[model samples]
Target: MSAAAEDEREEQYAFPMPPAGGWTADDLDRIPGLPPHTELIDGGLFFMSPQTDFHMATLRLLEFALVSAAPEDLYVVREMTTKLAKRDRPEPDLMVVPRKARTSREQTWYDPSDIILAVEIISDDSVERDREIKPRKYAGARIPHFWRVEKSNGLPVVYVYELDPATHTYAITGIHHDRLKLAVPFPLDIDLTEI
Candidate 1:
């Protein structure tokens, strides 16, 4: 492309570039009505497509179960953004957080330390990202627990992991198909097929 055309194209794009230092979590507030599925990773925005009915169904069921099992001081939320760093904010499919930490309804994202558990329900479009990139980011942020849900033969398979602070990675705790029971982040028991 010619320099003039390139300049014209750039001018037509109204969105301003991030400052030299990069974007911070505070920058997200400036974007009015940001889509619930949008996430910020290392200063770039990634938009996830709408989930399938089965995926949503699984997520809602899991959220309900977690909330029911959670203690009064802790609760579960769906698609809440977590501020992992100045340039990284990820919206896990569901999260369990302390009620005290979530008292500030004005905040767009929660601090990673406030999050006790992060869950992701995978679909065709997000299989690799949910399985790989997100776990690394969540573990690096020191979130204590992570759960990934995968569908196998039309059943939900739950993969649970706990952070290993020594290595700053996650260690597999358990994988459940028919039922899920975990002691950490409080005792959670859920029937996979119920969803």
Candidate 2:
């Protein structure tokens, strides 16, 4: 591409400037031209990177497995944000939320209490947010369960966590290499190798 054309394209897609105190969760809805799956964390906007083959495959596998195993009362959603606070809204890769939480088809976010489990699949660019920042925020919000899926030798390794209500923190419950079997947040058995 010619330098002039490239410059024009960049000008067309310039990043949005944040407000004085940074962006609130509600700003996400009003912001135009923002990338899809944009998140608000600590009053800042986070744009997502392109999805990889491994990320897409693993997300599909987990969604299928969870949807099939979840009880009638629960619903599984992908890339939906849970509002933890006024300035904090982060989209989990997959979430198991109560069916009753769906107030309307137009609803774009869920309350932290409504989410039973939040899963994040790690990516090269998302290592810090997926592994540390998001988990801390989720735990602080008292989300019951959190799962971090990491790539290991071209396969997946699931690290499961359960919230400690007293301390408002997450405790590592189990790390499943081949199969993920859990009792809390409903009975679930998934084969990690399928990813």
lDDT top scorer: 2
lDDT of each: 0.85, 0.91
The lDDT of model 2 is 0.91
Can you write out model 2's per-residue Cα lDDT over 166-190, one digit (the tens) per residue? 9999999998898988887888898
Q: Which digits, one per residue and each the tens of the lDDT, describe model 1 over residues 1-195?
A: 999999999877546567778767767778655555678877887677878877988988898888888999997878878988888888899998888887667756778988899999887877777899889999999999999999988889999999998999999988999899878889878889987
> Backbone clashes per model, in order?
0, 0
Clashing pairs in 1: none
Off by over 4 Å in 1: 1-22
Model 2: residues with Cα > 4 Å off, grouped in runs = 1-7
Name the TM-score of candidate 1.
0.86
